[model samples]
Structures are given as structure tokens and as C-alpha cells.
Target: MKIATFNVNGINGRLPRLLEWLAEAKPDAVCLQELKAPGDRFPEAAIRDAGYGAIWQGQARWNGVAILARGADPVETRRGLPGDPEDAQARYIEAAVGGVLIGGLYLPNGNPRPGPKFDYKLAWTERLLAHAAGLIEAGVPAVLAGDFNIIPTDQDVYKPERWRDDALFAPEAKAAFQRLLDQGWTDAIRALHPDAIIYTFWDYWRNAFGRDAGLRIDHLLLSPSVAGRLAKAGVDRAVRGRDKASDHAPAWLTLRKA
Candidate 1:
């Protein structure tokens, strides 16, 4: 099975490019983030037309997440992250596709450090950590994939010095991401190509893509049961160069059939 994670930036605006990729890539399963549309606004019919069934948790003009299974409906498992009753953001969605659990998320950007947003970001990580531990403890074959929005290491960013104080590069965020790895989730990309400078996101400003100034923020992590099945992992960098494309390209992995 092939699975992919992409932050479309905005689903409605990028629908065409999305559909094009779906057709060309033909991923068995897809985790999409940043829909930037409400639940009612999700273009379900169009997605279905492209030969995929999806389940989405959308928020107006902001965070959203969805899971798509080619030629089948994703069996809904959960919506939104747990551990915070007061907090409400369409940033996490989980489903089952072809016997594999898919956890798709759009982790908070938490820009402008030393503020409430940043605080919320850290708090949310704690919540995610708690829940992620449970998933691991459950011993299920799971793939946690999405735009984590955290620049994991100096190697993952083009210019670490330039983003020293940025939230995505914040020490706390990186540490949290590392903790997830310590929990035994395989960072598929890094594990497969340790020294390669693979980037999945490039800002439109300053000709970032043209200059190859990018960051590997989006990720796909596999649990122990699924990690051994990983046959190939890659980033569809060409997609990021398309006309009016999303700042992020799709990160994907293929699992060997049992």
C-alpha cells in the first residue's frame, strides 16, 4: 500500500492541483492538512469523482485535516485530538484504510514566540504526546502522517540560523518531535535517506523553491508493526513547482504486501 501526506495550504483554492496529483500519483491512501474550509464546504463529490473516499474535519479559514482511501471509504476512527475539551481546531483526523491506521494532523505553527499561540502550541504537543503513547501501546499497525510544522533538525532546514527564533524551529517544538521518535516511531524519510537533504515545503516568497531553500516539515512516521514493511519513501518535489501549487509537496511511503 502507498500512503501520502500533503498540506494543500488551502483545499478549495488548490483543488485542481490536488486532483491532478491524485490522478498522477494514485496513492492508496492520503493524509491532507490545512483544508482552510469548513466541513460543509469540503468538496466531497469532486474528491469522490477522482476515485477516492474521504473523511474530513474542517474549520473555517483555518486548520483542517482529512484522510482519503483510493477506491474505498476510510473507516472513521476519531476526529480532533483528545485531552483538551476547551480547545477546538480541525487539526487531527484518524481512520482505517486497508487494515492500516492513519493518523493525519496539522500541528500548530505557533508563530510569534513568547505569546499565547506559542503556549497553546506547546500545550497541544503535550496532549498529542499523551495520545500518541496510547497508540503505540495499542500495538496496531499505524502510520502517523501530516504537516507537523516542526523543523526537526538542523539538517532538515536549509538555513537553521535564519530560523533560529521561529516557532517551527523552536527548541521546544523540536524536542517534542524528537520525543515522538524516541517513542519508537520511525521517521520514514530520515531513516531511509539519512544524509539526503529532502525538503517538502518551500515558501513562495524570495523564490524559495527556485533557490532550493526549503524545509522538511511534513512527515510520515510508522509504528513498529508497519516500519518493517516500508519499501520506499520520497517527496514529490516537482509538485511544489507547479503553477500556484501549495507551499508543501507530498511526502509518501510504500508498504510491502504481507
Candidate 2:
């Protein structure tokens, strides 16, 4: 199956661009982040018309996540990440498509380090780690894909020096990301193209996209049960340059069928 992850930025504003990409790329399943719309306001009909059915966790205008499966309706396996009853941001949604578990997440962007937002980001990462441990224990083939909002390593970002103080690439953030990897999940993109400078997200400021100044924040992490089946992975960088396109491009991986 061809599985992809993309941060569409905003579902309503990027509908046309999203449809165009979806038709051209034709992935079997897609995990979307940053829907930025309420559940009632999601363009369900439009998405259905595009030949996919989705399960989404939505907030008004901030964090949101969804999983869209082509040719199959996704069965929701879980909603928000557990461990924090007070946590209410629509950041996580998981589902099963043809026996493959897929999860989409929009991790918080904790900017202005040494602040409350940064603390919340770390706490959220801990919660996600706890939840991921549970999923790993379930022993199912799964892929966690989305905008993690954490620049994992120097290789994952354009310049380590430039992002040193940035929240996304902070030492604490990188450690949290490493903790996830240590849990027996394979970073699918890195597994396929270890040395390639593949990037999936760029800022819409100061001509970042045009300059190829981007970061590989969006990712597809596969459990060991599914990692051996990995066939291919890539970033649709062209999509980031399209008219009315999102700051992020689609990152995808294809896996051999069991």
C-alpha cells in the first residue's frame, strides 16, 4: 500500500491544491494534519467526492488530524492520545485500513523556548511516548505519520546552527524524538534514503520554499512488523511550490502487501 502524510495547513483554504495533489499522487492512504477546522465544518462531501473517506479529530483553527483511505473506509481505532484527561487539542487520530494501523498527529509547535508552551510540548511528547509504548505492545503492523513539529536531527534540517535556539530543534525536543525512535519504530524515510537531504516542510516566510530552506518535520514511522515490507519513500517537493500550496509537502512510503 502507498501511504502518505501531509500537513495541509488548512483544509478549507487548501482544498483545490489538495485535490490536485491527491489526484496526481494517488496514494492508497493519507494522514493529514493541521485541518484547522471544526468537525461539523469539515468538507466531508468534497473529500468523499475526491474518492476517499476519512476519520478526523478537529478543533476550530489550531491543531487537528485526520486519516483518509482511498478505496476503503477507515475504522477508527482510537481518538486523542491517552494519559492526559485534561489534554483537549485535536492532535491525534488513529484508524485501521485493510488491517494496517495508521495514525495522524499534529504535534504542538512550541516556539519561544524556556516558556510554558515549550514545557507543554515536552509534556505532550511524554504522553505520546506512553501511548506509543502501548501500541507497540499490541504487536500490530502500524505506521505513525504526520507533522511531528520536531526537527529530529541535523540531517533532518537544512542547517543545525540556524535552528539551534528554535523550539523545533531544541535539545529537549530532539531527545524526545529520539526516545520515540528507541521504542523500536523505524523512521521510514531515513531507512530508504539515509543520506538524501529530503525535506517535507518549509516556512512561508522570507522565500524559504523558493530557497529550498526546508525541514523534514513530517514523517512516517513504521513499527518493526511493517518496516521489513517498506518498498519506497519520497517527498513530493514539487507540491510545495504549487500555487496556493501548503508550506508542507506530502511524504510517502509504499509497503509490500502481506
Candidate 3:
């Protein structure tokens, strides 16, 4: 099975680009983030025509998440993160696809330091860690995949010095991401290509893509049961350079069948 994650930026306007990628890449399962649409306007028919069944959690003009399984319908598992009942953002979704429990998430951006947004980001990650621990204890085949909005390490970004003050790469954020690894989740792409400079997102300004200035924020972290099946993984970087393309490219991994 192949699993992939992408932050579409805006699903309605980017439907064409999205469908095109779906048909071409043909990932067995895909975790999509940043729908930027309400639940009612998800374009279900268009995606259905593209040969996939999907379940999405959408918020108008902001965050959203979905799980799409090619040629098969995904069995809905959970709608939101567990720790906070008051939190209503459409940033996380979970489903069962071909025996694997897939957790798709769009973690908070948390820009502008010393602010509420940053505080929320940290709080959200703490929730993620708590829930992830449960999954690990259960020992189920699971994958936590999506636009984590986390630059895990200096090696994961273009300029460590430039982004040191950024929320995505802040010490607290990186530490949270590290805690996930410490909890026994394998960082798929990095495991496969440890020393390689791989990036999943590039800025639209300053000719970032052209200059190869990008960050590896989107990721697929696998539980031990699923990690053993990792065969190949990479980013579809060419997609990022296309017209009307999202700033993020799809990050994907293929697994050997059990």
C-alpha cells in the first residue's frame, strides 16, 4: 500500500490540480490538509469521479483535513483530537484504510512569537503526543501523516539561522516533534534518506522553489508495526512548481504488503 499527505492550500480552487495528482500518483491512501472550505463545499463528486472515496473535516476559509482511499471507501475512525473538547478546528481526522489506522493532521501554524497562536500550537502538539501514546500502546498498524507545520530539525530546513525565530522551527516546537520520535514513531522519509536534504514545502515569495529554499514540514510518522513495511518514500517536488500548485508537494511512502 502507498500512503501520501498533501496540504492543498485551498481545495475549491485547487480541485483540478488535486484531481490531476490523484490520478497520476494513484496513492492507495492520501491524507489531505488545508482544504480551506466548509464541509458542505468539499467537492465530493469531483473527487469521486477521480476514483477515490473520502471523508473530510472542513472549516470555512481556514484549516481542514481528509482521508482518501483509492478504489475503496475509508472507514471513519475519529473526527478531532481527543484532549480538548472546546477546540473546534478542523485540523485532524482519522480513518481505517486497508487495515491501517491513519491519523491525518494539519497542526497549527503558530506564527508571530510571544502570542496566543504560538501558545495554541504548543498546546495542540501536547494533545497529539498524548493521543499518539495511546496508539503506540495499542500496537495497531498506524500512520500519523500530514502537514505537521513543524520543522523538526535544522537539517530539515534551508537556513537554520533565518528560521530560528520562526514558530515552526522554534525550540519548543522541535522538542515536541522530537518527543514523537522518542515515543517510537519512525520518521519515514528521514529513515530512508537520513543525510539527504529533503523538503516538502517552499515559500511562494523570494523565488524559494527556484532557489531550492524549502522546509520539510509535511511528514508521515509510522508506528513500529507499520514502519517495518516502509519500502520507498519521497516528495513529488515537481508538483510544487506547477501553475496554481500548492506551496506544499505531496510526501509519500510505499509499504510492502503484510
TM-score, one value per model: 0.99, 0.98, 0.99
Number of the top-ranking candidate, with lDDT as the measure: 3
Per-residue C-alpha lDDT of model 1 across residues 94-149, encoded as one tens digit per residue: 99999999999989999889799899889998888888888999999999999998
Clashes of 1: 0
User: Better model by lDDT, 1 or 3?
Assistant: 3
lDDT of 3 by residue, 1-258 (tens): 999999999999898899989989999999999999999999999988898999999999999999999998999999999989999999999999999999999999999986999999999999999999999999999999999999999899998899989999999999999999999999999999999999999999999999999999999999998899999999999999999999999999999999
- Residue 165 deviation, candidate 3, in Å? 0.6
Output the worst ten-in-a-row residue range by lDDT, candidate 2.
131-140
lDDT for 82 (candidate 2): 89
- Name the regions of candidate 1 deviating beyond 4 angstroms: none
lDDT of each: 0.94, 0.91, 0.96
After TM-score superposition, what is the CA distance of residue 32 in candidate 3 from its true location, in Å?
Answer: 0.5
Off by over 4 Å in 3: none
List the pairs of residues colliding in candidate 1: none
**Candidates ranked, most accurate by TM-score first:** 3, 1, 2
- Measured on C-alpha atoms, candidate 1 has an lDDT of 0.94
